[model samples]
Target: MYRYTEFDKSFVKSRAAQFRDQLERWQDGRLSEDAFRPLRLQNGWYVQRHAPMLRVAVPYGELSSAQLRVLARIARDYDDPDPDVYRVASAAQGKLGTERLPTHCAHFTTRTNVQFNWIPLEKSADVMDLLATVDMHGIQTSGNCIRNISCDERAGVAPDEVADPRPFAEIMRQWTTLHPEFAFLPRKFKIAITGASEDRAATAWHDVGLQLVRNETGELGFRVSAGGGMGRTPVIATLMREFLPWQHIMNYIEAIVRVYNRYGRRDNKYKARIKILVKAEGQRYIDDVDEEFRQIVEHDGAPHLITPAELERVRASFVPPALHASHASHASVDEAEANANGHPLFARWLQRNVAQHKDPALRIVTLSFKRLLQSPGDATADQLDIVADLADRFSAGEARVTHTQNVVLPWVRASELLALWQAAREAGFASANVQLLTDMIACPGGDFCALANARSLPVAQAITERYQDLDELDDIGEIDLHISGCINSCGHHHSGHIGVLGVDKDGREWYQITLGGSDGSATSGAPQPGKVIGPSFSAAEVPDAIEAILTTYRDAREHDERFIDTVRRVGLTPFKTSANAVRVNEEVSA
Candidate 1:
C-alpha cells in the first residue's frame, strides 16, 4: 500500500477541521440542510434511513493489518455503543455470537472499499479524525467527484498477470485526488485498471476502464474504454483507444473527462453520467475525445507526460515481496496431508477457496464474508480483528477487499494452506463457496440506505439460508448473483450472471431479474451486460424464482458446464418458463 506524504497528511487534516466546523454550523442551525448536504457528502457522510452512512476509501482495495485495526478501533470508539436492529437480524440467523459487536461495522464494498451504515450524524467528524490518524479518509467517496481508483486484487501475484497494476493505480490516485477541474463534473466518475489476463475488476463497466496491453512491437500500453456504466440506461463503454502509450495515461484520461465535462447534460441529474453523453453523441464523442487528446499531447508541448524519475518514485513503492525458493516441505503440510485423507470438509474448502499464485510455492486464498444466514458483505468487528491476525500469521500482514464483496489473502504459502483454512474456520470466515450461488453480492438495502426500495440484505440472507446445502451449491457452480436495492447499482447487479435489481411497486418491494450478464474476461474481451428476464417479482417470490431458474439450467446444461455457458447455449426462454413457476422453494418450505 502507498503511504501518504506530508502534503497528503496536511490535506486530510485541513479537510477534517473544515468539515468539523461545518458540522457545528449545521447543528447550530447557522447552515441550512440544503446548504450543508454537499459539504456532508464531500466528507462521505450520507443521511440514511436509521443513521448516517460513511464510505471510507480503501485505496486499490489494499489494507495493511494495522490500518484495518485502525478501522476496527474507529468502530469501537466513535460508532454507537450498540445497534439493536442488527443484533436481532443476526440472532435470527444464528450469527449473534458471544463476541461483543461494534456499534457499526465496516461493510466491504463493490469498489473494494468499506462503508459504515449506522454512524451518528453528530459523530461524523470524530470518525474523520480517527481515519486521518491512519492516513485513511473518505474523500471522493460521495458527491460528483472522481471516486476511488480500483485495480485487480490479485494484480501482482496472479498466474496470468501482465504487470503489477498497483503502481499505475497509485499514480492515478495521487493525480486525481484533488484535481480542481474534475471535482465538480456533471456527475460522479469512476476508474478501474486491470493488469491480468482475467478481468476480475470489471474494467469495461467503469467510466474509464484501462486494460494493460502489449502491442505487436512489444511496447507496453493500454486498451482504454470510456463511458461504460450501469443505471436505468445501462451502456457498455466504447473503446476509446486501442493502444495508448503508457506514459500518456494521465493526459488521455484528462482529455476524455474534459470532453465529458463540456458536453455532458446537467439539466437532469438522472441523465448526467458520462454514459449518457457517450451514447447520445456516439462517434462524435469519440472523435472529440481523440482530437482533444491529440492536441493536448502533440499540438501542445508534452505537458502531461510524467518524467521517468517521478514514475520510478511511484513504482518503487510497490516492490514485490521477497519470496523464498519453492521445493520445500514442512510438517504443517504433512499434518494437513494426513488430515486431508479423513477430513472431507477441509479438502472441499481448499478446492474452492484457493487459487494458483504466480509463484508455484504460494497460493492466493479468498476469505469469504458471505457466510450462511448473514448479509453477503457484512463483517463483524471481531471478524476484522481475526482477519488481521490471520494475515499477520499466514500472509505478509496484508489483505485485500474484492469487488465481489469478499476478502483476499493474496500471498499464502501452499505449505501453510491447511493451517490457515483451519484458522479461518474457527473464526467463521471460511465458507468454501467462492464463485458459488451462496456467495452472492449484495448492498445494504432498505434496512440502512435511504435510496433503497427493498431490503437487499434479507433477500441475500434468505437465498444463502435456502441454499445452505453444500452439495446443491457445488452442483450449481460458478454462478454470480448480484443484488442492488435500487438503480444506484452499488452491488453491481448489471455485471452478474444472474442479476437482481430491487424496485418499489405500490410502496412494496419487488425485484427485477436479469439473466446472461458477464463482466467479460480479458481472455474473452468486453463483457455482456445482463438482459432483463421478464417482469418483476415480489420479494417473497424471489427465492423460488431463483430455484426454478437453477433447476432449468441443471436440466439443460451439458456435463460440468457453468450457468453462464448454459444460459448462452439456450437463451432466456427456458429460464423464463421455469422461473415463472415461483413455487418450488415455497412448496418445500410449506
Candidate 2:
C-alpha cells in the first residue's frame, strides 16, 4: 500500500479545511446554492435522492486498516439522516413497494470508490475532517473533472503482472488532482490502468485506458486507449498509441485530455462524454491528439514527463509489506487441502472466493458483499469494522477494494485460508458466489439514486432469493449479471453477460434486457456493450424473464461452456425469445 508522506498528509488536510470553509460559507448564506454546487461537487459531496451522498476516494483500491476504520466510523456516526428527511425518504420508498431503505451503510462502487448515502450536508465537514486524519478525501471524485485513477486490485501481486502500474497511477493521480487547466471539462472523465496480462481493471471501459506493455526490444511502454465509456453511448476506447514510452505517460495523457477539453461537446449533457467526440471524429480525433502531443513535447518541453528518481520514489511506497518476525506460522497448504476435501462447503468457498497470488505462499481472497437481504456492494458500519479487523489480522493490515465491488484481502497466507474463510462466513459475507449469478453488480436505484427510472435492489434481491442453492449457482458457472438504475450505467449494466437496465415508461418502471456483453477480461473476450434483446419488460416480470433466459442457456449451451460463451455461440435470439415469452404486458413493447 502507498503510505502518505508528510507533504501528502499536509495537502489532504489543507483540502479538507478548504472544503469546511466553503461549506460554512454556503450554510451561512454567503454562497447561494447555485454558487456552492460546483464547490461541494469538487469535494465529492452530492445531494442525492434523499440526503447528501459522499464519495470517498480509495485510490487504486488500496486501503490501510486505519483508513478502513475511519470509513467504518463515518458510516456509523455521521451517516444518519435528519428525522424529517428520513421520514419523507422512507415514505417515498414505501410507495415504490420497497422494504425500508438501509442507512448507516457504505456502498462499494464498481470504480472502487466508497459511497455513503443519508449523510446530512451539514455534517459533511465533520466527515471530511475525519477522512483527512487518515489521509483520505473525496477530491475530484465528482463534477466534470479527472475522477479517481483506478488500477487492477492485484497490481503488484498478480502472477501475470509485467510491471506494477500503481506508481504510474499515483503519478497521474498527483498530476490530475487539482490541475487548473483540466478541472472543468465538458464531462467527467475516468482513467483505468492495468499491468497484468488479464484485463482485471476493465481499462477498455474508461475515458483513458492504459495497459503496461513492452516493445519487441523489451523497452517498457504503454498501450493507450481513449474515449471508452458507458451511458447513453457505450464505447470501447479507441487505441490511440500502441507503445508510448512509460516515462511520457503523463505528458501523452495531458495532450489527449487537452484535445478533449478543446472540442468535446458542452451543449448537451448526454453527448458530453469524450466517447461521443471520439466516435464522431474517429481518425480526426486521433490526429488532433497526436498534433497536441507533438506541440506539448516540442514547444512546451514535456514538463510532465516522469523522471527515473521520482518513479523509484513512488515505487518504493508500493513494495509488498514484509511479514513480521514474531508472527506465528499458519497451517500448511496440504492441511488446508485436507480440510477442504472433508468439508464440501469449505471447498465450494475456496473454489469461488480465492484467487492465485504472485507469491505461492499467499492468496487473494474476496469477501462476498453480494448476498440475500442486503443490496449488493453495501456494508453496514459493523460489517466495515469487521472487514478492517480481518484485513489487519490476515492481510498485513491492508486490503484492496475490487472493481467488482468486493474487498480483497490481497495478502492472506495460504495456510490461514481456512480460518479466514470461517471468520468471513461468521461475518455473513462468505457466500461463495464471487462470480456466480447471485454475485451480481447492481446500483442503489430508485431506492437511493434520484436519477433512477426504477428500483435495482428489488430486482437484484428477487434473483438472489431465487438462486440460494450453491449447487444451482455453480451449475450456472461464472457470469457477469450487472444492473443499472438508469442509463448512467453506474452499475456497469452495459458490460454484463446479462444486463438489466431500468427504464421509464410513462410513470411505471420497466427493464430493458441485453445479452452477450463483455468487460474485456480473458474469459469475457473483448470490451463491448450488450445488445438489447427487445422492448423493455415490466419490473414484476424481470425475474421470471431472467429465469427463462437461464433455462434457455442451459438447454442450448455446449458441454461446460460458460453462460457468456453460450450466449456468444448461439446468439441472443433464443435468450431474447425466452425472456420476452414471460412478459405479460404487451403495452411495454407497444
For TM-score, the strongest prediction is 2
Task: List clashing residue pairs in candidate 2.
Answer: none
| Local distance difference test, each candidate | 0.84, 0.90
- What would the TM-score be for candidate 1 when compared with the true structure? 0.93
RMSD of 2: 2.3
| Candidate 1 runs further than 4 Å off | 81-103, 323-339, 522-526, 583-590
lDDT of 2 by residue, 67-151 (tens): 8889989988988756566567657655343245676789999999999997888889999999999999999999899999999
Clashing pairs in 1: 228-237
Candidate 1 overall lDDT versus native: 0.84
Instruction: Quote model 2's TM-score.
Output: 0.97
User: If scored against the real structure, what TM-score would every candidate get?
Assistant: 0.93, 0.97
All predictions: root-mean-square deviation over Cα? Answer: 3.8, 2.3
Off by over 4 Å in 2: 82-94, 324-331, 584-590
After superposition of all CA atoms, the RMSD between model 1 and the true structure is: 3.8
